[model samples]
Target: MAKINWKPGNMLYPLPAVLVSCGNNKDNYNIITIAWTGTICTNPPMTYISVRPNRYSYNIIKETKEFVINLTCENLVKAVDYCGVKSGKDINKFSEMNLTIEKATKIDAPLIAESPVNIECIVKDIVKLGSHDMFIAEVVAVNADDQYIDKNNKFHLDKSNPICYSHGTYFSLGKKLGTFGYSVAKKPKKKYRKK
Candidate 1:
């Protein structure tokens, strides 16, 4: 076995690649691909997304105090990367990328119609970090595509082929091993037959 030492940096990989939509209306909407997003709390449901201060969508969301976190799938990989690299100041992302802006149930920012799941959030606070600003938001509503729901009323989000950001690449979600709590859960014993 060999060992090596490395400088500290952001080595956390396999993060949720989400398209955050923010603007006053559909006419001025913009989508910014973000990997620095995650759930923060459970009560009242909160999440956080880190954005650079100079990004186009940053000001829009800061002023509006609302945005939609649309989960990206393998099908949206192109648009997702495009949105991240390009600035809204130069182009109309929704129209240029052929994305639809559906009305949000509880926010000004519209949801991405192509996304399988749209999470509406209202920014509760903003923390200024060195490189990026973190927008801590409270989840207002969640809209899921009806097609992903099974006949049993269970939401099959895993079947959507979700995409994730790792290092600098995008990847489709891998196979599932077991449900939560399966590791320590006791297995039922089988009845023995007379030999």
Candidate 2:
């Protein structure tokens, strides 16, 4: 089949749509929905989120050098889209979205109580890249809701039904294939019982 030529653009789709919570103390807390976020390093657990300077939460995170990457679930899709399109300056997102702010362990920024996982972060560096600035942060702490944990203590993040952003649309993650190292992993050997 022949394909039509399309203009060169950012066609990289299906990125985690997370609500990054920022600011210190109760009075200054804010949230900014971000799709331009990804794990940068595995050794020290580092991640980056790119935000435009005009975003209200951008300045707060820049000035404070800290934020929480709250993983969005299926239920959080509405708030995630709302937080991205609406400015924190014009509205109290927590109140408007009916989201609860819970106390974080290591940072002053509040965690989204509704989120199954919250990754507390401290900004290590900022790179200015035209329309957006990338915040490189060290993951300080990760909090997960106990409900998603199984009796075996296996955290079933997949059951949370995480949401992702792609080409201006939000989508829920679907299905699971093999896990890490499965391709090269050795198969279990079977033991023959004495007949």
Candidate 3:
């Protein structure tokens, strides 16, 4: 195998493309597509999203200290990409994209009604990094679409056909392979009964 080296940069590919909604009310509500976001902790439940300081929604999120991460599905790719490119300062994103705003439980930030999952987070801290600033937040509430939840309440997000960003393109999740601990766990034993 051969490998080529390039300049130091963000080469981490295949990241979840999510719509991050912010602002205190309908007046300033905005959505920004973020690929630089993920879970950072489990105990306290933390996640982060990186955005440039000049972005229209940056100050809204900074001042409010809260936002909602709307997980994007295949159907939301157009809106997701549009939100990424368009500036909230010029147009109303929710209206332009036809995305509905639903009230969140823990945060005042509105949730995307059509999103598969809405994760409400409170900004715990902010880290200043070159190009973008990282907003470290504690997940306060999570809302999953009722359609993705089963009768037993198990969330089947895979069925939603979630989309991810790779390089410069969007891709859908593929078929099932194995779940957590499936390789290490032993199969259940069958019991024999006398006829």
Candidate 3 has which clashing residue pairs, if any?
none
Question: Which digits, one per residue and each the tens of the lDDT, describe model 2 over residues 36-77?
Answer: 999999989999999999889988999999999999999999
State the C-alpha lDDT per candidate.
Answer: 0.94, 0.93, 0.95
| C-alpha positional error of residue 142 in candidate 3 after TM-score superposition, expressed in Å | 0.3
For model 2, the stretches where C-alpha displacement exceeds 4 angstroms are 3-5, 187-195
* Cα-based TM-score, every candidate: 0.96, 0.92, 0.94
Candidate 3, residue 163: Cα displacement in angstroms equals 0.5
TM-score pick, better of 1 and 2: 1
- Is candidate 1 or 3 superior in lDDT? 3
Taking all chains together, the TM-score of candidate 1 against the true structure is 0.96
lDDT of 1 by residue, 49-120 (tens): 999999999999999999999998989999999999999988999999999989999988999999999999
Colliding residue pairs in candidate 2: none
lDDT of 3 by residue, 1-195 (tens): 999999898888899999999999889999999999999999899999999999999999999999999999999999999999999999999999999989999889999999999999999999999899999999999998889889998999998999999998999999999999999999999999999
**By descending lDDT, how would the candidates be arranged?**
3, 1, 2
